[model samples]
Target: MSARPEAADQSRGSAFRGEGLRKIYRTGETEVEALRGVDLDVAQGEMLVLLGPSGSGKSTLLNIVGGLDRPTEGRLFYRETELTGMKEDEMTRFRRQNVGFIFQFYNLIPSLTAEENVQLVTDIAADPMDAREALEMVGLGDRAHHYPAQLSGGEQQRVAVARAVAKRPGVLLCDEPTGALDSQTGIRVLETLVRANRELGTTVIIITHNVGIGAVADRVFHFLDGQIARIEKNDHPIQPVEITW
Candidate 1:
């Protein structure tokens, strides 16, 4: 594993700021609380890892921060714009313009080739990288014409990463991005993410159950029972290849 030098201007601004964040879901007669008062500040160009077991509220918080869901209570700000009070259309626009999401499932269109899948996003973005360029960033320049079914698990995930980043979003939110892959494949995905953060200066927040993955992050947040239990900062973040399950 290798360590990259920290960005000299990484601490210049805030990417996200949240205060008293909360989420609640009610189905029939049951009420479930997914997040409980999460207050967080993610610096621009920093890599943050959220570690917790199932039902720990990390995923819920990620969803809200990424503009996929609304918080039941609390305020969230992307830079200086408040997200908590935005309408559905406003949130949609915010997500489209500022956030990139990567999930455990690849979510690639089966009928679209690798480059075409990435093009789908770039087509709508105001300022996007060329689809081929995005694929090249993830080491998939040669697989541009391949369909999802023709790619390996890791390759498919890389294609998904290319699609998410083609728009050059300011923030990248990942939810258990390597949950379905083997250790070696997972490491490859992590390497791609690290490279993206370093080169594009995107603020990244990742949710994972694997503790070893935390070593690559600038800060690791431990979640327990719907709240942040603690946060640990790594002065010298390592590479994904050094992480062990």
Candidate 2:
């Protein structure tokens, strides 16, 4: 059963809305406050970058937004759909319908060919581009028949990008997407993400430790002590190729 998105409240003009978001992890008597009452409104089609040190709550917030984890306290909405209030099954459907996530690792099956790996996503999506088309979009059309072991690290990551975008998701969530790649390869991956954002109008949110990566985003949020310390908006953002790290 493919998940189809409900009619969205496009008039809101926001991809995600958060109010008083907080996440606390407890083990026995010890407790860790990962987030502290965070509030935010991410505009539709905007590219946002989250930057912070470890334990600063960047990944925790990303996980909550992507439906991988629930916040201990707060409200989160996708357009008009209230995510925090949804049942687990509802959240699963919502995520499948509207969100695409990319992680630091490629996560491709070793035995599958590049096209086969991407096909796994298209098979379940309500509406998806052809696996070959997705591969071409990431400049891997010529290597679609190759297995993961036959591809280079950068090529493997590109295939992962193809798989995520093939679903035509409304939002793309990437956590340390380019952390495992070298500078040149990282730029290529960023370029592909930018192309997807522009072509598909997907709201892009990326979490990365590289401050240089922020140059490509429309806004950058710096997190500290479980809160957003600062937000910098770029009126004229540079391209990924122009970034120096």
Candidate 3:
């Protein structure tokens, strides 16, 4: 049966949709199931928090959604494009044009300045802001010339943020982005992410074990034992800085 018009419209408003998503791994005789028939949708311009314990398949699902990993079964769609069965080159192109990834550890080159690092991506992007402008968006304008080793962990991460957003991707996937920093520093990184979503209209998905971080997200998904146990929507998400660690 066809869904109600309003329901269909609501689904269309989402940037990503996953239906019956599953992933399994086999090593020798041992088999491991990372995800089992999980379904999810993330709205456009929404900041979603993925909260889960270790080995809950949160990372696996995030990777698949970002096209970093291929799924064992099921499907993932970005707007109208089916991402599940695309070729490797196609996926690479899709990722370059549509997705931005932020990892827990800021993988910055120690020899390169922040602007230089950001410039690398801007050069490849179809339409990109100046490296200085990208740094300014993350509240790191003055640190543009600083090398990764000379900056604090938070500052380094912010540089990573600038690099990711410089490309102006449709979706931002952050995997434990603030894991390496102290509480205060972590807030700064989170604030940058929030700002990126609000100013640039990027759909941001943050995967973290910190439940406290959910207050800033428009929606939160709690993953338990490789499945989504609960989904919560916040009408008014608090600012990242206002929520204590």
Question: lDDT winner among the candidates?
Answer: 2
Residue 190: error of model 3 in Å?
0.7
Candidate 1: stretches off by over 4 Å: 1-10
Q: What does candidate 1's lDDT look like per residue over 1-245, in tens digits?
A: 11122322345577888888889999999999888887888888989999988998999989899998899999999988999999999999999999999999999999999999999999999899999999999999999999999999999999999999999999999999999999999999999999989999998899998999999999988888888888888999999999977
Kindly list the per-residue Cα lDDT of model 3 for residues 1-245, writing each as its tens digit.
11111222264387888888889999999989899888777778889898989998899989999999988888889988999899999999999998989999988988999999999899899888889999999899998888998998889999999999999999999999988889999999999999989999999999998888999998788888788877777888999888868
| Steric clash count of candidate 2 | 0
Give the Cα lDDT of each candidate: 0.90, 0.91, 0.88
State in Å the error of residue 142, model 3. Answer: 1.0
Residue 122 miss distance in model 1 (angstroms): 0.4
Clashing pairs in 3: none
Superposition error at 199 for model 2 (Å): 0.5
Model 2: CA > 4 A from native: 1-12
Least lDDT summed over 10 consecutive residues: which range in candidate 1? Answer: 1-10
Candidate 3: stretches off by over 4 Å = 1-12
- lDDT per residue, candidate 2, 12-70, as tens digits? 39898888899999999999999988888888898899999999999999999999999
